[model samples]
Target: EPEVTQTPSHQVTQMGQEVILRCVPISNHLYFYWYRQILGQKVEFLVSFYNNEISEKSEIFDDQFSVERPDGSNFTLKIRSTKLEDSAMYFCASSVTSGEAFFGQGTRLTVV
Candidate 1:
């Protein structure tokens, strides 16, 4: 089955550098979302995008973060400045609707 895939499943970054996490969502899906889990916390929605523009974004998605569909098969999340608190598991997800969502294994971001 086609599913979301993320690269550099694990990443360790400096506190103030930039990082880009990559994902390839299922080919047929139309909506994409990004969520983060802070260690043992519940998953929090960061943003959702469709038609090449943001549809919804949580407060967590601030000026430092951005997302894009750089190509037909790839989606990317970029953080302009990393922070120690940014350490978390970032999950890329796709949904046909609110009821049919699928998730990637996740990229563990470790900012030290």
Candidate 2:
């Protein structure tokens, strides 16, 4: 079965540098989302995109973040300026509808 795949399962970056987290969402799904969990915290939604535009974004999705579908099968999230607080498990998810969301194993971003 097709599954969402995220690269560099763990990354350590400087506080001011940039990082790009890559993902390959399940093909045939129309909705894609990014969520983050800060250690013991709950999974918080960052943004959702469909039809090439953002469908919804939470307050956490500030100017420092961006998402794109670079090709037919790849999706990426770029953080322009990493911060210490950015350390968390970033999950890439996709669903045909709201009821069947699936998540990638997750990329753990660590900023120091």
- Clash number by candidate, in order: 0, 0
TM-scores of all candidate predictions against the true structure: 0.97, 0.97
Q: How far is candidate 2 from the true structure (C-alpha RMSD, Å)?
A: 0.7
The lDDT values for all models are 0.94, 0.94
Candidate 2: 10-residue stretch with minimal lDDT: 94-103
- Write candidate 1's Cα lDDT for 56-81 as tens digits: 99999999999999987898999999
Off by over 4 Å in 2: none
What's the CA error at residue 103 for candidate 2, in Å? 0.5
Residues 1-112, candidate 2: write the lDDT tens digits: 7889999899999999999999999998999999999999999999999998889999999999999998868888999999999999999999998858899999999999
Model 1 regions lying over 4 Å from their true place: none
Q: Which pairs of residues have clashing backbones in candidate 2? A: none
- Model 1 weakest lDDT span, ten residues long: 93-102
